[model samples]
Target: MTSDKTELNDAELSRYSRQILLSDVDYDGQLTLTQSHAVIFGLGGLGSPAALYLASAGVGKLTLVDFDQVDDSNLQRQVIHREANIGQDKVASAKTNLQALNHHIEISTVATKLTEAELADLVAMADVVLDCTDNFESRFALNRQCRRHGVPLVSGAAIRWEGQLTTYDFRQAETPCYQCLYKEEQGQELTCSQNGVLAPVVGMVGSMQAIEAIKVLLTLPTLMGKLMIMDAHTMQFRTLNLPKDPDCKTCRD
Candidate 1:
């Protein structure tokens, strides 16, 4: 399963039997998933569920990136980190949990912040990049790198019962990127630590990210030019079209 060949073993077939049952993710789609590589940035609320679902769904390789350590506070929303792993680096804890969930997949961890060049290199090698990072700076950096590398990015953010999910398929000439929707000049960024977020809110967004990542790998329809916003407080969901900004600094060429 690690080589260029894409074949599912009997065990793999059985393990992903439920997913393979779907016409959307049939045998071919499952094999595509097994041959795909997904890079996840941030191991907190969003990254936690995204990584878990991706691993359980049998994405062949996962690169988990996070520079922070797990805090006791993170356990409230970051389900991948156990109480015992509170002091451990987030990438290390996430890898431990992900491997325990599915040992057949390859899980790599980067426990430090990456420079621009380094991030670009990683993005270039990924089939899809999951932007679960908490801040605007990281999100902006990831968006630029993904756009430069022409990799699909599944971006999710949740703070204070509100969450948003979107995908940018940089391979598409007209796809809207993160920078198209947000400007770095908008300096006041809200965080769960500063505000507050329901555990399930981020979980939902992260799970959707996993779904989008798998869809991107399988060449299925995705939310490439749409943003899905969820108001957990009101239990409402709205989707809006995201047009590419010709003036966007990152994607405007």
Candidate 2:
């Protein structure tokens, strides 16, 4: 990790000059971002923007994991992929786009599905994890791994005209994890492929996920104990408290 007082290179100082001017993210906070390591799960709608912004913001390292490949349907909301990358693995495509955005940071790609042990290892090494996957299974697995590692997770989901964003900071003992809100056994999972989602809805949620990721990395106040809901149809937003469940199997002792 770079020291708070470490001098910034001319390009770095010029590139981040705007954010450095902000009182909240001055030199120290920006330095914190540069020292952070983020692991992003899923490279589709939510992960696309989350990964891009984190890289652009100068996160020191990013490991992108996704087993799927780009398809024509993804281009609408998956801004990181282009027509030329339609058949490429999502992580590979995302890596290309992110690398083009910022060449100073480190970017890694996991094009294959990760086994339980592999996921655990990655989560253990990450300073923060972003759960942008659409399925409940992956979310549950990632949540459990994050809890075990005591790492914070920025989770986002979008389907139809609705979107949801939240953070689970396992480092904070009382904060509720993803399992507290959605039990693993619950059925009737929804997906954009079947439910149909507005393009901008995903973009909105993903953008929020990126913002939450940065906040988590910087030790800033986050939506760790709350859920932010957005309705693209009515153009309305709401937030509600998310209390920790003492019996949560994933987070409880």
Candidate 3:
């Protein structure tokens, strides 16, 4: 028996029957996901898995922004890029994986990195932003754009089995911006190159990142205004309920 609660037709049903079975997405939730646009930055260790799941879960449009190319070292954590795709652009490699996961969604890729101006322009065009970049420069730049545009952001980071996930919604008073947690001068203190992250851990964190992004777009309950950290060694989870810093240059703006 078909219910009027779903937006997917017979084809989509045949493709995502399992998901549709869940009461959460009987029909309307699935349609919301299939109609929203999510912009992901970096497309590396963390962004790779996030983009993959976002596309698979039927996020209407996936915009990938990256300026790097695939490398043999990237295969250790960049699940979306294969050994055979070593020399190709990371954005292109990501698109291939995203399409293979779900051909129904529109995959938009920017093989070039988004400059300050470019990032602002793209943020304006997207409903949500995912800060998956490894470098602080890009992360800060993206965070600034998210603030100026008042866009919801899901930021995730992973390194050597240590990972963090947080959501920012300036629309809500007292929400902490990325700057509140990681000050600018700290820089790329923990990069995959130096810290050496586990491949699966990156996948785990990135997958969660995607889940958070989906929740935000779906207007579903999520870890908004909270910082969640995970450690693989002790298998511990910590929730830090911190208030927005009044001096935060990004959010306080």
lDDT of each: 0.92, 0.89, 0.83
Q: Write the per-residue lDDT of candidate 1 for residues 64-161, one digit (tens) a residue.
A: 99999989889999999999897999999999888889999999999888999899888989999999999999999998888888999999999988
For residues 150-242, what per-residue lDDT tens digits would candidate 3 score against the true structure? 888899888898888898874566668888888897644767788688888888889999998887876777787789999987889998886
The TM-score between candidate 3 and the true structure equals: 0.93
Which has the greatest lDDT?
A: 1
- Weakest lDDT window of 10 consecutive positions for candidate 3: 1-10
lDDT of 1 at 118: 92
**lDDT (Cα) of model 3:** 0.83
Return the clash pairs for model 2, or none: none
Decreasing lDDT order of the candidates: 1, 2, 3
Error of 3 at 238 (Å): 1.0
Report, for all candidates in order, the number of backbone clashes.
0, 0, 2
Total residue pair clashes for candidate 3: 2
User: Could you tell me how far off, in angstroms, the CA of residue 216 lies in candidate 1 after the best superposition?
Assistant: 0.6
**Structural similarity to truth (TM-score) of each candidate:** 0.97, 0.96, 0.93
Off by over 4 Å in 1: 1-3
What lDDT score goes with residue 253 in model 2? Answer: 53
